[model samples]
Target: MNAPANQIPLQSATVGSDDEIDLFELIAVVWNGRRVLLGLMVTAVTLAAIYVGLTPKLYNASADIYPVNTIQLALISPGFSADAENRATGELSPELLFNTALMKLHSENMAEQFLSTTGAQVNPQGANPQTAKQFLDALSVSKEKSGTRAAINLHGTQPQETATQLKAYLNFVSQAVIVSVSRDLLAALDASIQYIDRSMEQARQQAENKRLDKAAVLAEAADIAAALSIQEPRIDHLAHTEVTPFNDKLYLLGTRALQAELAALQSRKQKDAFIPELRQLEAAKSALLMDAEKVRQHQTSIDAFTLPASILAPTQPAAPKTALILIAAVVIGLIAGLVTVFVRQGIRAYKIRTQSAYMAGYKKEILRREGHYAVL
Candidate 1:
């Protein structure tokens, strides 16, 4: 092995020569199958082009809704205060209102409502359950990561129509919130009004009962004065006979005054005037009624939340990306072309190797037979 230093250089040269020859053979294989490779590539590109062309185009439209700004908050604050007495109606804070609208935007009930209302024109098949479900699925409502805003997105064949529908859906959600809150507010006001009415009625009844009791006391005193034959004030014996309060002894006013007071009390018609709390109760009731009226009058104008920006229809189609599809086609075509070339070359090489081995075996057998015949 140590005597082969010169042969090592020769062996290395032979290895280099074999590697060069293999590289050239590979190049030859590719060159000879150029037609097949080119055909496959062209076919792949053509099919991709056809598929891209036939696909329908779609456009996306999105609208953003943010929490109510201070201006809108100020506008609706007075209305919310009207229901302060009944917390069961819930507070309509800006965050709660915004969340409510966002919830309604994604709710199935809203989908059905839109389908029956504005969606009818877009989808004339009417709001069957299936249709409503499909419409709901088409809608996308997502809150931004910052949590300050939410977005509603939709895609369709017509950009303008899609944008219009999205805007209408937003309006529908806003209106739904307004209607729900207004209804609760009105109900609370109505309950307050009823409660005030009951209180006023109770006050009037108590006042009337007190008036009747006073009249009875006056009647008894007048009878006692008439029996004693006293027609005028009798302060002469008041201090001497264990003097009590005047109210405890109405007879001291004499029969004439007592009779007059009794007649007046029996003839009183406006008992409410005697009820001290009646005026305050009436004022409160009037205030509640006014609030309810104001709510009704301005319910339609109330904006629960604000739109931060306008929803614009995208001018470009979102689907059927032309450049991307063409580039993908080229890449796929190139890959298919190379694969086809290698596969064909490999099959041809395998066939040639098989034939060469068979031919060598047959020639060896013929030589053996000729040698056998010569020996014979």
Candidate 2:
């Protein structure tokens, strides 16, 4: 059956009244637990303040670095130039050099090396895994949006100390880059020198072999001349003619001349003078040796990178933010207190409903027994 319109409106009004009463009860419960809420908030704020006081303050120091110019690149790598062809070799590009520095800065090996060499109070044995990780965690290298510069940031307890350490670390990385380049240059020069030496040696061997062959040919010719009893000059006109030196007619030279030429060739000790290309190889080897020396000498004078700005130490601590921590603590405490109040109210309501239901059931059983007695 359909209910009347007035009846439906009355039922809706009754439901709205119950909801309003419940809302008031909830408010009352929260107000009665105000002391508990205040106590919780105070405890949380106190703890947060204590933590702020106990934690050590950390300051940040940062510096910017950019790629060195072409002149500096030349200083680092001998024969390097600003030409596109040279840059195409990959080893001579300024961008590649700067990226290499960035890679080293982010490497764990570099962190360990810095810890071990700088005497930063690491383990006595050396830079252990934990120490190296901590050092890396405290340091950061980030490139700028323009991609032309990179920033190095470090955290430490003291501002001055942090700035000084950052500067020292930069210097160390620069020296390492320079040394690596110098070592590579020397290795290349040494390789070239070795190649030249091998070529010279091979040329000398070939020349000596040719000399032996020539001597054999001369001895055979001398024997032939002696059998023929020729004194000299069967080929006296052959030298003036366009005939090749190895022509068979040259064998007609007199026995005395052939024997004298063979003896002179056999007595020669040095074959390098006969190798036409050996002098050019010697010159190249000497040039390589000189370049290696120049690289060594320039190692101390060259700069591997350039700093765009000085390292600036921060005056304020980067961590242990007191105000933000305290505000967060207050917010958490209020939330916890509200939750606790609602939970307590819910438990009380459940217990009261349970007791009322149990008492009503007991009374119903008594009434049933009394009615049974009357019926009997």
Candidate 3:
């Protein structure tokens, strides 16, 4: 049989009402189960607190590394000159050097070098893989906004250990850079020494050649003077006798004049003439050698490379952030508790609706059975 149109519409409306849930009803359900919600909130908070309290605390050690402009020193060094090959490499800007240092600071090679330098043996086999891993885990390198410096940070369970590790890492990086620069400087110094040797040798050779030329000129002048003296006797006797002639006297005077001119020319070409120029060249060579020595001193001295600031004790723990943990726990607890309350209320409502339906079906069946018996 077909249900009445009005009844069908009313039934449809009832089903729609069941599907629509009200905000007030949800609030009422939560309120009715306020005890359970509170219990769940308290339980969640307690668990979070326990976990936070039991977790190990980590220490953070931080330091600011200011890369010194050592490239300027290289540019100014007299012994170490940039050749065409070096110029082809381009200028070493502060930014590039900083990035290079930063990369080396975080490199595994540095970690291994550090381990060897510090004698920190971790395993029985003398392999420090674990320590290396720990060091890498703790290490962090980042650039600052000012662009002149970088920040180094490390984390460890102990404050002293963290600080010490950071200091060692910085020392390793600084020493590595200094060693590299020193090697280059030393190599340049050796080259400069060789160049100076060649230059001095050449100067000495030229001076010797000048001396030989002066000696040959003096020998030739001496020969010419000896011949003039031999003729002098003949010219003097003729002047003393009645054969004293005008051509003879003229020849004598002319010969004397030639000797005087020769003497003047010889005087001009004396050793003294080349002494000043040769001395100047020697002085220049000496100065070059001195500058090379100065470069060697600079390389030997550790003052060329400036190390970063020393590492200090960590001011705070890196992990187990108390305020953040507590805040997070509170938020999670509140949410979980509210969700639990709503879920419990929804389950109870479902069970009540199911029981009412069952009861209504049973009642309808009984009524239909009674109607059938009465009709019979």
Candidate 4:
């Protein structure tokens, strides 16, 4: 009386077969959903083309920087020691200096300085902090691996603006470094001069004290010689005095004692002499002052660094490459089309499943009613 027990199982088996899609089924799915796939591809391509057309073209300007040895840039002061020169040389190596300059190109401070100093084509109205950050964002720096040369590249909407910004950025970094080093040297020179002054003052005071002590010793000897009945002018001969029988024993003893005291004082004075040291210090101070002057002169002589002739001029239209954009659009269109095909196939498959289940139930109801009629 009921529908064949196998009917439901057979229908389920058919549904399972439909779900087990193979290459032919996949091809059918795509063919059935061809319209949808076409629509998606057209839409994606159209949107991409519109966006590309609306986007402004960008220009790129690049400048080559040949980093001069930082040591050459800085004038060594007269009193700069060999050790100091070695230290400076290490810090100013071509590689180190190039990296330092490269980093400065990206710094916010350098960006702001560049903006303030020159007429930037992108932000001709003068830039605020936000615009300055944008300026830094638009910059790129690269250094040569084997040489002291570096490169600065900048992007902007205008070719002239791009070039100007690149030049300004390079100038700002060079000036900043020179100014910083010059300031440091000036400070060091001042410190050295102060130290020298202090040393000279101490030496002068010590030498003056020794002379005063010597004078006091001489005065004491004079008084002792007077008490012993020895003449002031005749004290030099006291060391060679001939013992006489008529001479008072006390007088002879006092003369010998005075001679010993005078010798001791002369020796002490010679030992404490700081004159040679003072002269050397004075000469060093003069040399340092000369070096400081030279440094100042060098600061004044700073000119634009010579760069390689290989500097790249700004390209008029550097971005939104047509071929590249078209290629990207094609890739995106293909992806959208594939997605559309699968989605359409899934919807169609779901509807077929619903219709098949509905028919199966209807057939089962009809068969049940016929079985009841036969029983009646």
Candidate 5:
């Protein structure tokens, strides 16, 4: 509003009129002050050019990473037909692109990684707010014409380094930006498969060991039964050897009685009740065998369980795009220029209608004589 040197005030307002702006008159005023206006514009544009040239010529190095889910589009003749599966899988509208871009923008670690790679020194000698704004503003992620893909671009001091670092980080993040229910499911299934394999091996070993022990126990029991049969004949011989003539009749009666009692005891041993102890042992062994089989069967089931899809390693990161950056710079500069013009014009009008400056001297004088000045 303080018209820069030699800018003429083409039209002065009389106190009675509406503040209407005439474009032609305004042009004339500006023409009168064309040197100043042109000088300011030239200065601004020259500075902008200088900044665009000297401040940094950062070339963006970008990583191009496609979503793994979207990788299926590489097919030769993916159905051009309107099938639901095709529709669902193929053109999954960029539902989360905005959120994804925003998340990347707000990502502090990502930003810091970029900052570090670009050798973002804080200018220890001096901290300039305007410089910070320009550099910070340069790091931008924007959507390309292809609605599907996003372009992550960075501006910095060095071209190759900024390009390289930005692409590396952005590419990783882009690939990292995953929308996968299958991935989590696959991981869980893989873990389960591993655990089942370990369990299967253990079950097999245990079943083998139990089978061997059963065979050995059966063999030992047979040997013991044979020894008991041999001992039975010796019991009869010893009873006869211990007898004499005087006690022979007594011995016969005692032997007959003992034999009768032995017969009764042996008859009782032949009953189901007595045999049940051996049956129970056999039942226990059978039960153990059944348990071992079940464990093996469970292991087999685990071995059969398989994951549907495997995760593939990501290729390159998202890339820096020069076209996008230049576009944004042009837009921002124009906006800034427009804003500057309107604001300057408003300020000029405000000052033109300003009566405060004239009254300012009187107000100060009155203030200086606060006790003496009477209100009029």
Candidate 6:
């Protein structure tokens, strides 16, 4: 027959109670694997420590500023009929502060300008684009936030470089961006609008000239009417002294002619009204005057941002990042330990199951004492 029906495998863990683990056994397992565990731990920790040690010490540089409101509120209401938004509405908002940070990282114009302003010319030593990217990569930004404090960080390998970049960012961009558009600048802009005012005055004058011209033409029409009236009376006198007293037809005709002449003179004023050219000119003048005034009003001066923002120096220097390193190490170690225990315990469990099957006859020994038949 087979070597024994119950003959089973060994070389695995979990052979029932024999393989059940206690604290000492766990310690023993860990100790047994110590060489391997120690090797791995040492390798990992050493590599980590080495990497961290080799990394260059970073120094953070940063600056802060805010937009400010310079315009008086009274001037805002009548013009745009909207409340002028303040630049620095109370303290500097986190958003505007980040705006400054964005300029540092993303604003190509600002970045290029900063480089130029700082005299950072391309390296003449034949450094390629990759080298330049690498150098720039050395720069990093971090946001520091608290309940009532916030700051942006500019980190670099070199302390002076950090300071220089921070200073440049503060001077070139922050001050201008943070402050509300200055009143002086607004005034200058308004002065430019005065040119539009001058145009309006000229337009008004043109309208006045058109009015005067119309009046003068009407006055000439009045003179013609007066002359016609005077001639009509003379014509009536001629009718009254007709050559033949019996020539009633000529007298009647002269009377009608006098009436016709007076009527024609009175109608001259009405003709001036119907003159198409003069009517068009008057309409044009009125349109131009209305348009010119609108242009002047639109060209009026306005302030840009309402409230201004201002930032003082940082409340404190950048925090130490050593805590991050420590946390990282602990996390890495924990993962390693957990994985090691699972692998070792699983193997031990499998061996115990195999050995318990191999020791199947031990169950028969107990069953026989109870007078129970047991299969081999």
In order, candidate lDDTs are 0.75, 0.75, 0.63, 0.65, 0.43, 0.46
Q: Write the per-residue lDDT of candidate 5 for residues 1-376, one digit (tens) a residue.
A: 5778988757656733555677886676555555555555566555556555554333443333223232331221112212211221122223343345446654766456545655554421134322434444655656556644554555444444455545444543443333232233233333443444444445555655654554444344334435444323245545656433223222332433434444554444333343323443344334333433333333212211111232222233232333454555556655565555666777886886576676887898878798566544
Error of 2 at 348 (Å): 5.9
TM-score of 5: 0.29
Model 6 ranges with Cα > 4 A deviation? 1-15, 32-36, 69-105, 120-150, 175-204, 218-376
* Regions more than 4 Å wrong, model 1: 1-32, 73-90, 108-120, 123-134, 224-261, 308-310
Stretches of candidate 4 exceeding 4 Å from the true structure: 1-22, 63-67, 77-79, 82-103, 119-121, 124-130, 141-151, 227-229, 232-274, 300-310, 316-325, 349-376
Off by over 4 Å in 5: 1-54, 68-201, 212-376
Residue range 1-376, candidate 4, lDDT tens digits: 7888667544554667755659987788778778877787788778878887988777788777775655565554334531212222112244444566667777887777766776452552133333777777777777788666766777776676567656666766767766766677777777777777888888888887766665465556556666867753355555677633234332444545556655665666444254668767777678667877886877645523444444455655777786777778777877888887898777887899899999999999999999999999
- The candidate maximizing TM-score is 1
- For candidate 5, what is the lDDT? 0.43
> Which residue runs of candidate 3 sit more than 4 Å off their true CA positions?
1-15, 69-76, 79-100, 120-130, 196-288, 299-310
Model 3 residue 158 CA deviation (Å) reads 1.2
lDDT of 6 by residue, 248-267 (tens): 22223333443454455444
TM-score of every model versus the real structure: 0.77, 0.71, 0.66, 0.69, 0.29, 0.46
Least well predicted 10-residue stretch by lDDT in candidate 5: 299-308
What is candidate 1's TM-score against the reference?
0.77
Candidate 3 lDDT over 299-338, as tens digits, reads 4344223455567777678788877887787788778888
lDDT digits (tens) for residues 1-376 of candidate 2: 8887777444655666644556777779989999888888888898999999988887888898988888766654544211211221125557776877888887888777887787664322223433777767788899987878888888877787778778877887877877876787677667666767777878888898899888888887778778888767655555566533365655566778888889999999776788788887777667566667777877878556786356777899888888899999999889888998888877998899899999999999999999999999
Candidate 2 is scored at a TM of 0.71
